[model samples]
Target: MIGYWIIFSATTGNEFSYLTKHFLFNFNNVEDIFYRNYGKRAFIMMKIYSFLLTLPLALLACIPVRAGVYEPDKLRVYLKMDKRVLYSDEDVVLQICIKNVSEKKNFFDVFDSIKNKPGEYTTFQPLVYDYSGREAEITVPYKLEKRDIKELIRDLERRMVELAPGEVFIHSINLKHIYKLDLNTRYRVKSLFYPTIGEDIVITSDNELSFKIIAEKRYNKPSEREAVQRNISPSEVILLTLRAEKDKNWDNYLKYIDVEKFINAYPEYTQKYLRANFEEKNQIEKDFIKYLTRDRDDYLLHYKIMEEEIENSKRIAYVNVIEDRYGSRWNYRYRCRYMLEQYKDMWLIVDEVATVMQGAKR
Candidate 1:
């Protein structure tokens, strides 16, 4: 029986090699007990017991090992855009930020300055997606002589910079010069970074940034006559808020908000809270715009008023807004309160409170 078990175990070397060594001492003790006390009658019973005990171990050994989802390296990279919406004539500024999250210092080769010439360091490759869903790689063109390349390599070899833990290195490049953009078309851009010229370590952006080119401004300053003629309601104010953020029109957005009433209603917000002193109305308006647009993009897919309550000159509305970002949809439900006031004989939006409901994401 022992010889039979040995032959069965030897057939599966790779799968049960480590486990066989672990169970060998115990199996030897069991075999000694069976041979000394029970003799031949218990030999067949011992063989059956050994087979049952090793069955689970054999099954476990056949299972494949899986790798972890997270990356082992401690370096983090991110890309940001200065503006989400741009004109065709304007240059798009793309910034790259790299940070070392590990405790140890890491060395990286970067193009800090133009010491010799071009082709000294690794260039960034940007992925561009057009409105027609066509994707293309846009590369920056560079020309370098043989001597320039040699000098650049020498410069890069000597210019290896050390990054301490939690330290960030930032670089900015103009994409408009590298790639030509079409007017009235939306483009999504993602920047890829390589830490070394040999393409050893690579990190991509956390999220892609998109920008739309417009032939003319969708939002403009309304004249005094137009402002007076427009009837401002709570629902209209909500619509204006969405349109203003979509157009990045801060000036037109401010017209719909009553700054004094908002400050008085939400007095907990101070200069430190806003990161800017709100001594002037313009500064307060800017701070308010920043608060409303925080962590949001300049595009809205859909919006609906979930519920509304109106009594006398006050109203409260629960609005649902959906935004599509990088092929993922995010739903934001806001509970907004509004107070109606007479301004130049027209009902204007005065005080307001906007709170995001819990579990607002789908």
Candidate 2:
């Protein structure tokens, strides 16, 4: 048994020694093989992982962004007239004011200045006062930006200096400018070729002008008024003549001379017709003469003396030809308000009130 044990122990020891030597001998080669083939695989894997991690960043760098252009808004202009009714050839004063609300550049020019041509609108420019007169030549270049405002004022005195005699100047404005913009490349869509934008700087501009010109004095002559001789109605003449004859001694022969007195009292009342020799025999002439002769004296003194004699002379009731006594026809004097308009030939009562004198100049 002891011999068998010793032999087994020796065999086990030799097997152990052989396994340890073989492991030590192949260790270097195994390491070399791992580093050559597997190392390359690991390096390749690392490169793929790095690429995956950076892929999103690379895509973000190439992505497009939107761009835009901006501009300011424009303002508008308005005008008004104080009066509209004007007499022909009358000199009128016009007030002009200009305003702007915007961020942009604009220019203006006026007519009448030597530099300005005919049919051109006027602008506010610097003027110089010299020995000769006030001269406007230097122009002001105006620059504005967003929410900016500009104002200009003018009076008729300056306007008259520039205005030509008998030449009518039509005032107006012009908006010929626009805002420019450069779009960002983000909107560089294939459909569009250029990166530009355009917008109106003036939201509201001068669309129309409110203006008027009038003459200082009326061009019409006073002689243009329709004129005629006053004539008493036949009924009135008859009543007045009869009253005169009744008050005095009624005599058939006295009637003839009384008619001359009646005519003298109310001078030239339809004298043309009375003097005219009409071929037709008419009762109107006889009746007219008789009517005048009857009240010749009293009719003549009615306004001059009779009205003065009557205490608290009753208001003489009057009825116009139109027969509308209730209609207003009088007005307050020196307190008349007026509107501007081309005066018509027809006469207009100052105000449609109810008490005043009806008078005519021509």
Candidate 3:
């Protein structure tokens, strides 16, 4: 019986002292201040007997107790991230959820470290923030036991401290731990039990907060070498006409074709137009046969020859070409950038602009 009381007190942190005395102790031995008197005896003979006679009745205290069964408090600690995903330099929000299983209110302070003594419970606070700046600390209101209400408060301060400006940041949260309600009998009897626990729940987040650089333009090369080192391929430039012909997009076709290159290359047609406009003699008839039958292969070679002749006159050439001969008008201009590469070996030209000029005089 003494062992049973000892275990009960230990389990409840010695709070069962009243229950032990009133229910488990001998009623006759109790001296209520007003009722201090000799206990009633079954008989005069038994009364004279030693204390050992009542000792047997103490055995009744060992009746296995079944009163409030010791069930673990259903404690669930979890971390919840806000629905909005924050970008780099943006604020992050973390929510803390605490549940109490007891049928009373509980007060607890959630902190990163443990308190040294009984009075340090109220000294801890969590930091929080919004995207603009430092927000506020999250506080758990009076948590009612038995009935659990979910309280969502942002822990912005903790998140900001973990991530620095422009750091390779990944936002992940840990629940850390949980502390529950433990009754402090030294305080008010009405407040016999309060939330007394340690960190048990670790809250973590899978998605990280990141930011996108709004002003930066993403291209293949860096900014400094943009002008002198610009790469121009016939394939890239010729796409203007090919795409226009394929999708029949006249706007792009007109916008992209190289008019100057066409007139310079097709001298027979250019001379005929010049003669009609300036009353000079025309040379179109003399070159008519070659112009009509010239395929991409012949025309490209002639163009290469003309470019070389011009470079020869200038005394310098950036590129050289043996010939500019190509297959056909369509295939010749199809992404002519590649053709320019073959021609760039011996010819000097700006880019692979379109060879055919739309609406040009014959």
Candidate 4:
């Protein structure tokens, strides 16, 4: 009782005023009010009551702040999944973000900067389930043939990085390529991740990663998207490019054409791009897409890849294209000589020389 009086008297000066100002109610002077309302005994008791009310905040302030904190709300793992409606024509990309929201640095070896899915090279292990929580079917048989994890670790040792506080390392997985998803059914995907990949450190994904594959495109006819593939033949690349444009599937249409390469092929655009700033360069790429799609009259009607020639440095595709537009009363066909080069896993149209086919039909 004597100890309580000492604590209550000592706290009633500044701390009592703070607590009352922020938490309860503000007064000119709490000690004067309490003393005036009652004698010293009642005054002491009321001060003790106020002190008890603010005890938790006082105790929390006494706890020392520490570095390397790994709270769920602080440290995070989550998917940056995107779809303009999956199964439409876009890749089912599950971009994983491993972030360090601490005061100190964090290191993770779970994956390289890029990956198709979690595996020996990719490291994290994933579980995919259907809408009913049943294990999803691996529609396309996945061949997990690769070197051991030890070898991958040895090879990637030099390239690993430490994520500084407030930094995130991201990598993506194409779920559609990994699991066979039924149209309109939701799918849940999660991964077992060890930041160190072998031993102890843990970072958990706080969000439930889920998405659905909806067949928004008409199912009665064949989808050209099926032909939109990685590592496609040069002829297929040319064929899909024209077809994607005709169907107005912007993602696949631009997929086969490397916009940077296509835009820079023209000397004027190339010089302008080199002199332009970052924001302007992005505008130039958008201009390329706009130039292709802005006029419906320029849309391709029918295109046949006539020939594909392969040389040591580059590949060339000759396409005979039929052009028609409601805007044009009568227009003929075209012959486009497309120049392509190997870009990552597939071919992209880098350049094209088109000449109107004078004798061809409208």
Candidate 5:
């Protein structure tokens, strides 16, 4: 019997070696004369059997050149988490970004054959481990390995997505939905990306993100957001937010600005947050705010209100501010423009756009 892949190769019009095709042509003619001579038929049958035995091997010997991010040199998979510590009520989110690093652009990406988005559909097959060295459970619809490799390869080749050099495709994975994460435990997530779906070609990113889930934080007091919300100008709101950031007053700092809207300013965050569930939305906010509150030397050093614009019958305002920022390694001066909106008596910063200035100091 012909092997399934041999049939697939023929049906798909995969070119065989010239010698193999020539022999196959002759073998087809030989099969018609089986009744004429038993001796000739037996010899032809032996040759046919040998050809069948070696066909698969021949196919393997000249495997097609795999496209996409198959090797470390071609692409990079980065796994990252905004928050390393989370409350039990929050979702554990992991961001997977695949970047094309090769000089040549790829027309077909690994994600094409995947049913939904890779991380969203659990096709990433992410491995999660608790602090105790026990792996978390992940139940999914189907395993790729059980399916026909030829089918996977064929589907992958058919899907065309142009990924240029330095371009990235990002996906989100919520471990909270995939794994049974328990409270008060630490876990590490390592992700696998398939540029070509196979055991040998999986790209295992060296990056691993670990986070701890503790009991819900209920003791934290609600900020006196009312204090900063009333009768404030756009420039004042910017100053207040900067002061709160410098003082490490996260609760009050986030109150001066629309946290969700500000985080959504980033394209990546906007894409994920727009489709997120209630729990995931809250987790995203927490991760973003918590990240901003973390200790860093790059806090706003100085800012000057360069210009201000108020419109929409004074309900909307914009402020152009020059800022100085420095970390242990580097320093930069930026010109930032902020957008603020007035709701009732409260003026809240909703958006900000910034550009770097090449200079010695502000």
Candidate 6:
């Protein structure tokens, strides 16, 4: 009689050890039976024994093998908005909450320190879909081209913060200040939070947040007159233009500016160049406005209209803008001179130039 043996390694913690088993059977009478039946019965018995011996091993192969115990996910994310419906001009405050659901402390970049260089940090990239299933355009506050890559990397490296187990971190962002949403439209905003820059672990909310923007109440009702008219001065035009620029209303900005006169004054500036430059300037205006509106200890002291001169249809205004940013870390001021011309009872800005009175830290 011949014996069969089987060996397999059982997986243990970072090590492998083998276990062997043997099966023994007796066929001492098999020689006499083979001579009686011409070995036919012996061949059938051998095949049956071989199959019976290997059946258990074949069934064991189908069992799942586990090298380690299962662990729960480490992070959980949540997205919240103050109001589901709001006016188009109103700001939508988005709150992002990240909670560490694991037992051990986790290290992650909170993304609070890299506002000017958003590309360097993992962010809650948002996707907004309109009612028609079309994606809307969302503009970020800071652009990659505005910051140096090395500086951004340094900021990110130094900004890594720690979150304890079961602790939550919350961050709020103003959607109106950063993005342009359309009026009278419903949008679905979905966001995914990436805790680390180089890792693949991303946490997202179970469901998306929905919001609607309706037209302003004032604009909903019809008026008796064709249009409401208000008489604005040359100085008022400059202020209104600045306000429009701060609001990121590019169309309203061009409304107050005489593009034809601006182009004629600066022949080197083609229409395309003028439009592009206006958009760039609008972006700068958004940044400065954000700084002014920030919830910080610093404050804007005051701004003064230095001088205003009107000659025939042409007018020039000089203004001084100052702010006490971060308690004298740098003197923030701008000396701006605006040129305007009277057009159809409205003062239209023709051109302007500004010089930084004081430069900040590089």
Best by lDDT: 5
lDDT values for all models = 0.60, 0.30, 0.32, 0.64, 0.70, 0.59
Candidate 5: TM-score?
0.36
lDDT for 270 (candidate 1): 47
Q: How many residue pairs clash (N, CA or C atoms closer than 3 angstroms) in each of the candidate models, in the order given?
A: 0, 24, 46, 0, 0, 0
Q: By descending lDDT, how would the candidates be arranged?
A: 5, 4, 1, 6, 3, 2
Indicate which candidate wins on TM-score: 6
User: Candidate 6's residue-wise lDDT over 269-315, tens digit each?
Assistant: 44444566667756644543454345555333435566677775344
Q: Model 2 shows how many backbone clashes?
A: 24
- Where is the poorest 10-residue window by lDDT in model 4? 113-122
lDDT of each residue in 29-129, candidate 3, tens digit only: 33331122222432233334534555777787877643232222432333445533333223333343444443433233332322322121121222333
Cα error of candidate 4 at position 121, Å: 6.4
TM-score of each: 0.34, 0.16, 0.20, 0.36, 0.36, 0.37
In model 1, which runs have C-alpha deviations exceeding 4 angstroms?
Answer: 1-72, 112-123, 131-133, 136-139, 142-158, 216-362
Clashing pairs in 5: none
What's the CA error at residue 19 for candidate 1, in Å? Answer: 64
Query: How big is the positional error of residue 99 in model 5, measured in Å on the Cα after superposition?
Result: 1.7
Writing each residue's lDDT as its tens digit, candidate 4 over 1-362 gives 23333444566567656544533353446566547545799777766776777787789999976444433345577766766357645577777777788778655554443254334324554567876779786643223454455545554433445677989877677776666667777778776556655554455566667778776656557558866754577888877887877788878888888787788666767888888899999998787678766657545666676777877665544343444333254555667778887876677788887777654334
Indicate whether candidate 4 or candidate 6 has the larger lDDT. 4
What value does the lDDT take at residue 104 in candidate 4? 81
How does candidate 6 score on lDDT? 0.59
Cα displacement (angstroms), candidate 6, residue 14, comes to 47
Error of 6 at 103 (Å): 2.4
- In model 6, the runs with Cα more than 4 Å from the true position are 1-72, 112-121, 141-158, 217-362
Candidate 3: lDDT of 134? 37
Query: Which prediction has more favorable lDDT, 2 or 4?
Result: 4
